[model samples]
Structure formats: C-alpha cells, structure tokens
Target chain A: MRNILAIIERELRAYFTSPIAYVVLTIFVFLSGLFFRSILAQVLQMGLMSQLQAQQLGPRAMDMPGMITRGFLSTMSVILLFVMPMLTMGLFSEEKKRGTIELLLTAPLTDLQVVLGKFFAGVTFFIILLLTTWIPTGMLYLYSTPASGPILTAYLGLLLYGLALTAIGLFISTLTENQIIAAVLSFGTIMVLWLVDVLANNAESSTSKAVLTYLSILSHLDDFMKGVLSTSHIIFYMSLMLVALFLTYRSIDSLRWRG
Target chain B: MITVENLTKRYATKTAIESVSFQVEKGEILGFLGPNGAGKTTTMRIVVGFMPASDGTVRVDGFDVFENPLDVRRRIGYLPENPPLYPEMTVAGYLRFVAKIKGVPKEKIGAEVKRVMERVSITDVQERIIAKLSKGYKQRVGLAQALIGDPPVMILDEPTIGLDPKQIHEVRELIKGLAGNHTVVLSTHILPEVEQTCNRVVIIDRGKIVAIDTPQNLRFQLQGAERVFMEIQGPVPEITSKLKAMPGVIDVHTVGSNDGRHRFQIEGELKKDIRSDLARTVVQSGWGLYELQSASMSLEDIFLKLTTAEERE
Candidate 1:
C-alpha cells in the first residue's frame, strides 16, 4: 500500500510539474462552464415559454433544474473523452520513453501496485476536473431547489465513466513509448466507442442496434443523467474498468519479458 | 551473495546473452567487462529482476529470482545505464520515491535518502531538478539512487559512463568503498576501471564470457608467451640474430635503432622468462645492455585477443 501511494504521489507531482495538467484543466473548465451557461439559458427560456403557454392552456409542468443539470452533465461527459487521454497518455509511456520503467520494475513493488497507483492517480485527477462542474451546478441549489440525490448519482456515474476512460487510456499508454502516439491512439479508441453510440441510433436491424448500444459507454451514462440508476449500467462501467486494468497488469509483465 | 547459472536471454531476432553464468560472493565487487553490445546490460538487468532471463536461474541472497523476486529485489539496488530518473523531478524527490518503493521503513525513509545522497556526494543538489543537473552530477545521482535503502546487493550498469575523469575517479572510489558491505556487480567496457575497482572480473565478449578471474591472475594466465624488451647498444642485425639464437626464445623483432642502440622485443616459450638469458648473452657479447624489462600483457591486449581472435578462426 505504501508502494502504491508512493507511485501515486509521484504521478500527481509529474502532472502538476508539467504543463499538460494545467492546459487540460483550463480547457475543460472553460468548455464545461460555457456548456453549463448555455444549457441554463435554454432551460430558463423554455421555462418562460412554458409559463406563457400555461396561461393560454390549463397548466403544464417542467423540471427546469433537472433539465439544466442533466443537459450540463451530459455535455460534460463528452468533453471528458477529449481530455482524459491527456491525463493518462504519459502514465506509462513517459516512464518507458525516459527509461524510468526500469526503476519501477526492479523496485520491490509489484506490477499491480504500479498499475493501481497510476490508475488511481488518473482517476483522482479526473475527479478534480469533474468536480469543477459543481461550481455551475451549485448555482441551482443556491437559487432554487434542485434534487440533490440525482445530482449525486449523476456525479457517481460520471466518475465511473471517467474510470472506464482512464482504464482505456492506461492500457494503451503501456503499449507505446511515444506519449503523442499513446494520446492519439487513446483518442482514436475512445472516439470509436463514442461513435458506436451514434451508429446504434441509425441501425436498421434491431439486434445490431441492441448490441452496439449495449457496448456504447455513452448509452450507459444516459440513465444516470436521467436519474434512473440501473445495476446493469453500473456493471457495464465497472466491468470495463476491471478488464482494462487486467490488461494493463498483463502488459506490464509482458514488457519485462520483451525487454 | 548472488548465483547466476546459465542465464540466457534471446530476443526475437537474436540471442542477447547466451549461457552466461557468474557468482558474486558476500562483500565482493565483480566487474562485468565487455565491449559495446556484449550483453553486460542484459545480464545485470536479469540479476536485478529488471528483466527475466529466457533460460537460466538466478538466486540472490538464497532467493530464486523467479520463485521469490520481491524477496530478491528488496535486497538488491540497481542503477541502469540510463539512470531511470524522472527529469522533471528534484533529485531528493526521486531518491525519496525510490526509497519508498524499495521498502525502506516509513520512519527511516527520510534519513535513508539523506544518507544515500551524501554517500554519492549529491547532497548539495538534492533540491535541484534532475534535468538541470550536469552530466557528472546526474551520474552521481544515479549512483545515489542505487544506494537507497542500503540494499545488501547492488547491480550497476556502466555506473561511471558519461562522467568527467575526476567524476569517474570519484565514482570508482565510491564503488570501491561500497565493497565489503554491499556485494556489487558493475559493468563497464573500460579495462582500467575493472583493475582499479573490482575484486573479480568477468570478461564478456559477444554475449559470452571469455574469461573470469582476478585481474592479476588473468594477466598472468594470458601472458603465456613471456615478452622481454631490451635496448642493446650494438648493431641491430647482430642483436636480433643473437637473441633469436637463445634457447626457448620463440620470436624476435627489433623495434628500432637510435644512436647505434638496438631495441629488441623477444617472445619466449610458455612459462619461460628469457630476460635474464637475453641480458646475460648481451653482456657476454661485449655489448652494452642499456634497458631490459619484461612487458606483461595489458588487459587491453587480452580483451582484444579474447574478443576478436575468435573470428580469425
């Protein structure tokens, strides 16, 4: 456990010492705040129009805070795909490029400790970036009553989503020594998974659509955004994270033999 | 103590190191002497658990590397050729991280880092970023890294490379000082380095060990044909012919003539020292023997003979 923490601490320091962390954080914050403001404007305008229609008709109902929260969070999830790769591309690739893998491998620590340390470090950074969205979300609670329970579940879902993305990036990072290649490969891989969701919507065959949608990471997030937390969606993200981490463990072991 | 038996590592296209085996006794420094691409790094990596040998077993401190790697790793400190440093990190931070992972007790980690930094004489630059340090300082930082946790065994791959001459001397002294407490295995293509620092030398060539013994013994053993150099104040042809006539003399070649003094290098048969015989013959022949001395084979010649002589066959 101490070994794991040591790696985690070093990894965090590496992030903060370099410019990648600050650049990714700045871009993420700017984009998420922009999305949140636009979504809040759209919701408020729709709310105003609904109130006008309620006077003309009998009455109608709309959960403006839920709409705004769900819209803002769903947009933030797509933004995560763009930035999570930057967080994880250097996790192992930088080690290999600089030949620091020798230190980690020859140290008394196990391969799992190294992988777990990197994994949690990436997840921790993702959480830090993900938590920034709460600033915009906090406005809702201060001005009006927003359902806290669904917002908590939404954040949990996004955390798991980030974990799954981080796992994908972590495993890919181990396969290459070039950080740029690792980043591009991870981006390409996650984008493929993202596009699978769009393809599922256009599928002619019901069977093919079900399979693609089931495999889509974005499909699983829709339920969490809707405040409908299902066991299957949680299981999907958890299992993806687990399988990718298992691959990372195996890749690290294979690297020693290859060398 | 470390025992490596028939360690072999084969890459996809080539065999890196083949059937290489050596042992390091407690408190002994073994020099892995080899030229470039000679697999010295490959073997040291295996010894430190950095990589697996395709075909052999290595037992470190009685723990089989395959069966109990962590047990062996915790007892071994490794300094790879590249130093394995994070360039952005401070020297102190890097060592502290290494100490933590090497399983130093939490309470003693701070002290251990300080001790190792001081041991390698990098205490003054502990707070400096590694990438900004000089090459000599970087090499010392690498040494300081391997000294972390005070592991009983140390495997250093070309520890002194890229350092200035003075830094090389300092590192050699540091490594020599490490002997008798830490069993050290250092690889180098530098011959005098082995002579100066190591207790035993394993001369590897082309991924195979050509010789293994103490420095003096290797010199004596490979010096089978004794060579004697003499500068005789006489006719060059006469001195060469007269030296060739001596019994047990294998070969005679006159180096040069300066001021009517002839310089001759005479090769004698195995286990024969014809310096006395050649000197007596010169004195009796009414010629002045200005200088006469035996030239022991240098490690450089032995290395060249062992590494390159095989291809001639």
Candidate 2:
C-alpha cells in the first residue's frame, strides 16, 4: 500500500508539473462551457414554446430542469470521449520510453502496485475534469430551481463512465512506448466501443443485438443519465474497469519476461 | 555476494547471451568487459531482476532472482546504460522519489538523499531540472539514484560510457571507494578501466565469456611471447644472430639503423626477464649500448587477440 502511494505521488507530480495537464484542463473546460451555453439556449427556447402551446390547448407537463440537465450531461459524456486519451497517453508509455519502467520494475514493488498507482492518477485527473462541469451546473442552481437528485446521479454516471474510459486508456498505454501511438490507438479503440451501440440497433437477430448492446461501452451509461440507479449498469461499468486493469497487469508481467 | 550459473537469454531473432557464469565474493568488485553487442547489459539486467534469465539460476545474497524477485531487488542498486531519470523533475525531487521507492525509512529519506547527493558531488545542482543538466551531471544523478538506499549489491552497466576523462576518473575513483563494503559489478569495454578498478575481469565476446581472470593474469595468459628492444652500435647481422642464439630468445630482427646505432626487436620465452641478459651480452661484446627497454603486452592487445582470435576459429 505504501508503494502504491509512492508511485501515485510520483505520477501525479509528473502530470501537474508538465504542460500537458494545463493544456488538457483548459481545452476541456472551455469546450464544456461552450456546449453548456448552446444546450441551455435550446432548452429555454423549447420550454417557452411549449408553455405557449399549453396556454392555447390544455395544461401539459414538461420537466425543464430534467431536460436541460440530461442534455448537458450527455454532451459532457461525449466530450469525455475526446479528452480521455490525452490524459492517459503518458501513464505507462512515457515510463517505457524513458526507461523508467526498469526502475519501477526492479524496485521492491509488484507490477500490480505500479499499475494501480498509474490508474488512480488518471482517474484523479478525470475527477478534477468532472468537477469543472459543476461550474456550469452550479450556474443553473442560482438562476432556476433544478432537481438535485438527477444532477447527483448524472455526476455519478459521469464518474463511472470516466473511470471505465481511463482504465481502457491505461491498458492501451501499456501496449507501446510511443505516447502518440498510445493516444491514437486509445481513441480508435474507444470509438469502436462507442459505435457498437449503433451496430446493435441495426442488428436483425435478437440474440446478436442483445450481446452487442451489452458489449457497447455507452449502453450501460443511459440508465444513469435517466436518473435510474440499477445494479446491472453499475456492475457493467465496474466489471469493465476491472477487466481493463487485469489486462494491464498481465501486460506488465509479460513485459518483464519479454525485456 | 552474487552467483550466476549458465545464464542465457535468447530473443526471438537471436541469442543475446549464452552459458555465461561468474561469481562475486562479498566486498569484491567484478568488472564485466565486453565490446558493444556482447551481452554485457543483458547479463546485468537479469542479475538485478530487471528481467529474468531464460535458462539459468541467479542467486543474489542466497535469494534466487527469479524465485524471490522482491528480496533480490531490495538488496540491489542498479544503474542501467541510460540513467532512468524523469526530465521534468529536479535533481532533488528525483532522488527523493528513488529513495521512497527503494524503501528507505520514512524518517531517513531526507538524510539518505542528501548522503547520496554529497557522495556524487551533485548537491549544488540538486534544484536543477534533470533535462537541463549536463550529460555528466545526469550520469552522476543516475549514480546517485543507485546509491539511494545503500543496498549491499550494485549492478552498474557501462557507468562511464559518455563522460569526459576527468569525470570518468572521478566515477572510477568513486566506484573504487565503494569496495570492501558494497559488492559492485560494473561493465565496460574500455580496457584500462578494468585494469585500474576491478579485482577480476570477465572478458566476453560474441555473447560468450572468453576469459575470466585478474588484469595481470589475463595479460600473461593471453600474451604467450615476451618482447624487448635495445639500441646498439655494432654489426646489425651479428647482433641479430647473437641475440637469436641466446637461450629462451625466440626471434630477433634489426628494426632500424641510425648513426652507427642499430635498434633490434627481440622476442623471448614467456615469463622470462631477458632484458638484463641482453644488456650484459651487448656490453661484453664491445658494443655501445645506447638504450635497453622491455615492451610487455598491454590489455588492449590481449582484448583484441582474444576477441578476434575466437572469430577466426
């Protein structure tokens, strides 16, 4: 446990001391802010038009807070797909390129300790990124009344989703020593997982469609967006994270032999 | 103490090392001498538990490297060919990190880093970023990292490869100072480094150890013939024939002739001191002996002869 903390401290310092952290934070916050404004504008205009229609016909129900929060949270999830690779590209790849992996491996620590330490570093940065979304969401609280339940659940969903993505990126980082290759390959892999949902919708057979939907990385995320806390969805995300981490552990073990 | 037997590493494309074995007694410095691509780095890496050997057993302090890796690693301080340094970190921060990972006591981390920094003479540059430091400084930082926990065994691969002559001298001196307390296995292709620093040398060629002995013993074993030179004023053919006739003198030839002085190159039996005999004979034969000098084989000659002679076979 102490070894893991030591590695995490080193990894976090490595992230924050370089330009990569600042650049990534700035880009993510700026883009999320832009998408938030656009989504808020669209939500307000639709709500006003619906209110006018209700006056002409009969009273109708439209949950403005839920609609806007869900829209904004969904956009944040998509934005994460683009930003996660940058955060994890250097986790193991940089270590290998600089030959610091030898130092870590030859130290009095196990491979799992090194892998977990790096994984948590990426997750910590992602959490910091997730906190930036609260700024726009916090603005919603001051101007209008929004349900706290859905907002909390939405944040929970984003956290789990981001954890899964980070684990995937960490595994890919172990595959190569070049950060550029690691980043591009992680992006490609996540893209395929994201597209699997679309593939599931077009499948003609029920069994094939069911398996494809279950395998899609985003399929488990929809329930959390709807403010539904289901054990099945939580298990999906947790299992995905564990599987990726396990693969990373095995990869490091093989690297020791292959070296 | 470290003992390695039949350590072999075979990559998919080719074998890096084959049947290489050696032992280092406690408080002895063993120099691994080999040219480039001769598996010097591979052997050290396996011994330090950086990688496992394909077909051998390595016991460091009685713990098998493959079986009890953490036990072996905790006792070893390894410096790879390139210093494992993070470019963004300051020298002080990097040393602190190494000390932490190497498992120095929490209270002693600060003192340990300071001791190693002072030992390597890098206290002045402790705050400088590793990337910006000069190559010599970076190499010293690498050495400092290895000395962090003061492990009983240190495995350094080509530690003085890129330094200037003065820095090389300092590093060699520092390594020599580490003897009698820390067991060291340092690899180098430079001949004099082994002769100057190591207690024993294991000469490797083409992924195999060709010779293993002390520097002086290796020279004597590989160089079968002894040579001597003398300048004399006499008939050149007479001197050559007379020198050749002496007991244990293998060959004699007149190399050059100057103003009434002839220089003769003479070869004699191994382990024989023929210089005094030649000098006495020259003065007795009514010849003016201007100079008499013995030319023994240097380590360079033995290295080349051992490496190339195997290639021809």
User: Considering every candidate listed, which one attains the maximal DockQ?
Assistant: 1
- Per-residue error for B278 in candidate 2, Å, reads 6.1
lDDT for each residue of candidate 2 in B1-313, tens digit (9 for 90 to 100): 9999999999889999999999999999999998999999999999989888889999999999999999999999999999999999999999999988888989999999999999999999999999999999999999999999999999999999899999999999999999999999999999999999999999998889999999989988765678888999999888888889999899998899899998888988988888889988999999999998888889998898888987687
True contacts kept of 2: 0.76
Q: Give me the displacement of residue A178 in model 2, in angstroms.
A: 1.7
DockQ of each: 0.84, 0.75
| Model 1 error, position B312 (Å) | 1.8
Put down candidate 1 lDDT per residue, B1-313, tens digits, no spaces. 9999999999999999999988899999999998999999989988888889999999999999988989999999899999888999999999989988888899998999999988988889999999999999988888888888888999999998988899999999999999999999999999999999999999998889999999989988888678888888977777788778889998899888889887888888868877778888999999998999888899888888889877898
Which ten-residue region of model 1 chain B has the weakest summed lDDT?
B234-243
Model 1, residue pairs in steric clash:
none
